[model samples]
Target: MEKAIFAMIASAVVGVFVYPKFIEFLESKGSKQEVNEFAPDAFKEKKKTVTFGGAVFVAVPIIVMVILNGFTLNRDLFLLIMVYGSYALIGFVDDYKIVTEGKNDGISAKTKMAAQLGLSVVFYAVYILTGGDNMLSIPFLKTPINLGIFYLPLVMFMLSGASNAVNLTDGMDGLAGGTSLIAFIPFAYYAYKVGNFGVLLFILAIIGGLIAFLFFNRKPARIFMGDVGSLALGAALAAVAIVLGKEVILVVVAGVFVFETLCVIIQKISWKLRKKRIFRFTPIHYSFTLNGWDEADVVNMFYGIGLVCMVIGFVLLSLS
Candidate 1:
């Protein structure tokens, strides 16, 4: 418990102090965001914001976890780090392409999905070998649903979907970071309750870093997490749920991300079937924004929804 607390504080401190310098360093190197051409006009305004700030927050937590865990190589932590790192690499590649090549087309969608699946397969293999179960814990149910052969695909979907969902939710300032930061709190509690100190420590570290990132990530942002931060965060967030055997709780805790993804899917489906777009832009947050809500208002509303779900999830976990 003490270690978990320390991990959170240490990483938060790192995020608070390191982010400004990191932003300056990236800015010096001409590392900045390039707007997606398909993005709404409002998004184009963020084109010059320094990006890939996810690098510092993501990397700091992992480092803090290692130090707090006494440098011991726990199998679960290793798997978590590997899965998280792989997604970060994918996001980094995209961010790098955008920064260096000066284009929004980073890695192709096909290539990115392939890489995500490959990493998910590796994670599944390691998890099973490490005696991980094939059971999926459904919220509010005491009995676990065993997936058998279908488990692998589920893992693939969770990992891939999480990464993409977060990426999609990154269109607004602090939307992704703030939502994720709030979501992690309950999960960290779950980990602590289950005596999984390693998971708890890792989450606390992430929470700390995210808190600091949110400082600059709020309205009128000085930095953007880009696909790099969002992808890595989404993967890590999903990975933690999987590790804790609370996959269903993830849906509730990360309700905003799920809602955002559903909006995109629904919008696409609606366009194909009905020949009309459901929202002015995909992802519900932007729809709200385009509907005349202030960006900060949209973000705050989503945060409220996220908080409610987090509370609901924590209660369910507690009852279970």
Candidate 2:
């Protein structure tokens, strides 16, 4: 508990102080955001502003974690940090490419997927070597069912799915970060209750970092998290869920992410099947935008929906 509090304080202080300066630095370096062609007109004027600020938020927690937890490499912590850092690096490259080239295009989809898959393979190998069980916990059932050798592919899917889910959810300022903070609250409690103090501290640190980032990430965000923050956050969440043996519940608790991803999938499938698009735009949030809703309104609505889903998840978890 003491470690958690200390980490929170440290992360918050560092994040708040460092973020503005980082934004300025990026601006000076010509590292600004390029508005996507598919993005709303409202966002166009804000183009060339700083982005990828989530790197700072993520970094603070990791530094705090290492400093306080010491240098010993626990399997879980090692995987969490490695996956988080790797995804962040991938995002950084993408963001840097976009900013430097003055185009929306970053890394190609095929290349990015190849990189993510490679990282997933490494993560699974580490898990197996660390004596991590391949059994997945059923939400309602207390027992875990082993998938044996199939777990490798499953882990890869989980990691990749989570990464995309979060990337999809990053359509609005503070939307993904705020909702993720809410989701992390439960995971933090679960870790604490399960006597996983290290994981608890990690979650708490992330919560702190997100809270600090929210100061600038709210509506009309000063800096966007972009893919850097989203992918890293998603990967971290996956690692935590895997370690806690609560991967199934994560889908319920993070229903907002799932819904966002589903909207994209549904839209794509509908377009492919009927040669007609379902929504004005994919990811559902842009649907709201196309319907004349403000970004803040859509974000707030998602946050409300996230709260309800989280409550249900908590109730079900308690009952189970």
Candidate 3:
């Protein structure tokens, strides 16, 4: 745990300096924000800020983890980072194509989903082959459920679902990153309790890097994590929880994300079926903004909810 703290601090200190340069590098590459056409007008000012800041933060944690481990990779550590890095590649391609081509979206939705599921298959193979458990832990169930063959589908859904939930939540500054940082706290405890220090180290490293990223990511953000950050972060969270066998708690800890994703689904369904809308906006958080809530207020409010969710998740994990 002390080592994890060191990794976190190291990642944060390094990220603080490297991030500014990274933003500068993005600027040099002409990687500026290209707001979606339907996005609110307030987002116009963000056009000058750089996107893909996720690359820097993610790199910090990975590099720190490697160095701390004396550059060795155990099976669990390898799979953990494999999940993180691979999804990041998908997001990197997405962000790069979108920025370079000057498009609102880089890959088609179908293409992105395919990429996610495809990588998920690879991860599932590695996980099961490495003797990972197939038992699913529920918060209240006295017995753990064995998914066995069906765990594959769980892998696919958790990976894609978690990543996109964060992506949807990324509509505001400090929203996704801040909430995600809080979300990882309980997982860190679970990893340690389960004697999976590698995963704990990974989580701590991320927590530390996120601390630095959030400084720049706050309201009037200096940079955005873009798909690269959000997708990778979400995928990593799902992967971590899966490996820790705390899948049920992960959903509760990151409930804000699930809640937001549900809002999107409900909104779409209501619109398509009834020729009407549900919330004033999708993702639900944006509805408050449209109703005259300040962006910072909405972000803070979500952060508070995320904290409460994290506490609930921790308690549930303890009981389970």
Between candidates 2 and 3, the one scoring higher on lDDT is: 3
For residues 248-267, could you state the per-residue lDDT of candidate 1 as single tens digits?
A: 78888899899999988999
The C-alpha TM-scores of every prediction are: 0.97, 0.96, 0.97
lDDT of 2 at 303: 95
Q: How far off is model 1, as Cα RMSD?
A: 1.3
Local distance difference test, candidate 1: 0.87
| Residue-by-residue lDDT tens digits, candidate 2, 254-290 | 8999998888899889988999987888778878977
Tens digit per residue, CA lDDT, model 3, 197-263: 8999999999989999998989788898988999999999999988888887778999999999998
Top candidate when judged by lDDT against the true structure: 3
Better of 2 and 3 by TM-score: 3
Per TM-score, what order, best first? 3, 1, 2
